[model samples]
Target: MMQEWRRRRQAKRVKPGDGSPLPRFRWWQLLSRSLFTLELVGPDGRPSSYAVDVRQAGDKDDGEVRARLYVDGALRMVSRVPARFPVPGGEIEVVVGGFGMKRCHLVAADGSERQLVPHPRSAEGRRARFDRDHPVASRGVGALSLLAVLVGLCLALPALAETISEIPPVAQAVGTFKSPLNLPGWLLVTVGVAAVVGSIERALRLRSSWIDDLAS
Candidate 1:
């Protein structure tokens, strides 16, 4: 019921596109842009093409991220993140995180959903190809990223608790708490960067958890 309400709200945010030609994905924008495509059969037994394009650089500069939906190489609609664009059979849903895309899938009327295929030149596409071509190496990298995020989460807990315990009322109840792993600033920065990269790697695979969603 709650999910339905959110979907309805997101669907309402969709706005008609200006029918501009779908822009080509460039090599230089590999890191900051993402594109995913989908094809569905219409009621008349005809096939239609759809694409979702995200410009993360603009999103980072401002707080709002916009997704463009293209049909048959022409712009059809656009919306901010958590968008739901009505398509032929179902809805194209898009959600994004700070580092990259978190969810972009076709949600059917019966509740089944399937991810959109990333464009050949997009970062997500490259990552998917890597996984297909090098399964063992891909799993190893994924495990490392998971470990990095886990370690970062462990380090953060005590610091967060210490912060919470420092509040006047809380401190009176539990006493002042101090974080145990008080390393140098530089090492902390390194861990922070690792955590961010780990999160981005996870985002590329469309794998997300509560922590990444909140942090990003």
Candidate 2:
């Protein structure tokens, strides 16, 4: 029953797409756009293809990013992220993070899920290729991203606590506080930048935790 409500809510977000053709991904759009494709067989055993495209750096006047769904190479549906489009056997879900996409997968009715294949020219594809070609280096990079998020959290929590403790009412109740890890202003800024970079790296791999996302 709850799942049905969720499906209905997600379905309402979808709007009919213009009868326009899908755009070709270009080299310059690698940083701004993401495209992924899924292949499946219908119940009748007919093969069908679907594509999910997102423009991360696009305008957010509507207060959210949008994901466009294409069926058999024609535009079919579009919805704001985190989007869920009902398909043959399940739904195509798209979610976003601070820097880019954090999730893009097909969720089956039986609760199984699989990520879609990214376009070969896209950044995600290149990153995946890097993982295949240099597993050790890729793992090292992933480790660094996690480390960066942890360090950022360590740096952020104390600062946040100190700020809250400094408030007049809070100070009166709990006394003033200072973060022990205070370096310089410039260093704090540098760490913040690193955290953002780490968040982006994690998103490329479709990995993020609430804590890491909050810290970044």
Model 1: lDDT equals 0.87
Q: Write the residue-wise lDDT of candidate 2 on 89-147 in tens digits.
A: 98899988777888899999999999999898998888889999999999999999888
C-alpha-based local distance difference test score of model 2: 0.87
| TM-scores vs. true structure, each candidate | 0.91, 0.90
Tell me which residue pairs clash in candidate 1. Answer: none
Model 1, runs deviating above 4 Å: 59-63, 172-175, 213-216
- Model 2 alpha-carbon drift over 4 Å, by segment: 1-7, 59-64, 166-176
Highest TM-score among the candidates is held by which one?
A: 1
Error of 1 at 132 (Å): 0.9
Instruction: List, residue by residue over 1-216, the lDDT tens digit for candidate 1.
Output: 998799778888899999999988999989989899999898889998999998886666565779999999999998988788998878888888777888999989898999999998998999999999999999999998887788778778888889899999999987999888879999778877888889899989988666764332
- In angstroms, give how far residue 100 of model 2 lies from its true place: 0.9
